[model samples]
Target: METSASSPSVSDTPPGHTRIFLVVVDDTEEMRAALAFACRRARATDGRVALLRVIEPSELQHFAFIGKIVEHETREQAEQMLQRMAAEVNRRSGHLPSLHVRQGKPVDELLALVREDPGISVLVLAAGRGKEGPGPLVTACGAGLGSRLRIPVTIVPAGMSEEEIERLA
Candidate 1:
């Protein structure tokens, strides 16, 4: 696991305690909605947004050299994606978010981050619109995993409009 901040820490709250909204970053279209919701909520509540991008283990492990190259490239791509999203989060919330990159199963990494970071007060995800159902993270959380988490999980609907999210948040 690797973690870094996009800019100078934006999590410094007026009060000693900070409410960190954790959003898992991915390539899915629904991910935008989750990010938007989290940013708006963070802005409204004087909280901070944290993004976690989990890179699945490469299948090229059989070729040690190739695996190492693949791992480096994958991590680079994840960092780039996080940088782009961090700009959006900063624009919306007036604070740059802390970025995290991990290699493992998405659910496992997410759970571990939450357990390790007590400042993470909420886990926000967006439900998928595909026939495959509400995506793996949402499905996993709904299947009792959410109950095990110390923080509350917020699942945003994929089709929700920006205006609706702004109003709700």
Candidate 2:
């Protein structure tokens, strides 16, 4: 995959200049909108978007082989989804989003990635418009955890149009 100097792929970056805006990507339109917002912002900042999806770990101790197959399939699905998102980013923002798949709770994994990667500058998420309120990860991260985290979390409201996101970018 060819990379440009201004906007690099979301997954990889040049040494000493890897500013990242991590986006929590899920199977939701709200998540997609958040990703779009992150891509625009990253492009504006000469950074990249790390598109991350977390899958729940399988519980198949009764059948270890089946559990392994389930795990593999889950990872594949996540990859396919991320690839589609990357393509959208390329089409809309002229940048390829970096893809990541982790098997664990979203909040824990997201926070761990932030701790592990110093290049990550912010966590981007979409506020769920559901009556129950925002998703668990967004609520947890936006709660008291935000103060403890090294990076800030940017919450894009649900249904924000592409034009508004571009303006913010």
Candidate 3:
């Protein structure tokens, strides 16, 4: 978890006081839509944005040494990606977002983060446009995983244009 040390802890905030829009950072195309929606919504609500990047464990079970190296490289890559995305979030929301990196299944990590961070008022996701279906996280949310979360989930359509998002968010 690479959060800003200067910022007050969300757990310290009174209930219903802090509004942090939490968005999962991933390589999928719909991720951009989710990010845009979260940023715009945060700006509109005078809230902050929090980004969570979950690093799935490497699948090199046969080679312990190789798995360690791969895990280190993966963490580094996730950190770099978070830095780049944080800049974009800042540009869009006029504030730098809190960055977090966790190692586990995406759904589990997301749930844990929300449970741990009291300031995360909303979980923003984007429905995929692919013929297959919405991406894994969104699908998981729809498959009863969302009911386990303490915060509301917001799903943005992947094909929504900036104009539409601006008007709605």
Candidate 4:
């Protein structure tokens, strides 16, 4: 479905029965772990899941000389990675979630997906990884999506043990 900047989700939800979740992940420990929890929780709640992995255009542009080659390669890699994560979740929770990968800004693409999918009632984000340094800061930046989206967003810390996260899931 086509989505505008003003409106991100494009589908309609039922009055009160359906719950759609938008879970964004990247190639990070926190993102994977958080999604694992979110997947389990979604399964228990009988909610539909949309797993999103954002591929930054800038990152792709930097290697423009091999853009075509790298783009397809990276996309495949990301797809495989997401599929594995989803598989793990399915193993634990018996839910196979939908997956999507887009080339653009992480925040912008995530917000757009949320707007386009009307079924989405909540957003689940993984916490930043590592100590208070550049890596953690960059990863944690996704938290801004919570404040930006109209739906409620749950942010899970990256450091949580799988068991700890599964309890909530």
What is candidate 1's lDDT per residue for 68-169, written digit by digit as tens?
999999999999999988999999998889899999999889888878776788899999999989999999987988988988999998699889999983
- Candidate 1 — worst ten consecutive residues by lDDT sum? 7-16
lDDT of 3: 0.85
TM-scores of the models, in the order given: 0.93, 0.84, 0.92, 0.75
Tens-place lDDT digits, model 4, residues 1-169:
2212122222544625666666776666676666766777777887656677777654556677787787777777777876776676566556556667788777777778766666777777766656753233234455454566778876676577778876773
lDDT of each: 0.87, 0.73, 0.85, 0.64
Judging by TM-score against the true structure, name the best candidate: 1
Candidate 3 structure quality by residue, lDDT tens digits, 30-135: 8998999999998888777888899998899689999999999999989889889988988998877888889988998898888887778999999999996999
Candidate 1: residue pairs that collide: none
TM-score of 2: 0.84
Task: Write one digit per residue (lDDT tens) for candidate 2, span 82-121.
Answer: 7777788777656666666787877777777777667677
Clashes of each: 0, 2, 0, 6
What's the best-to-worst order under TM-score? Answer: 1, 3, 2, 4
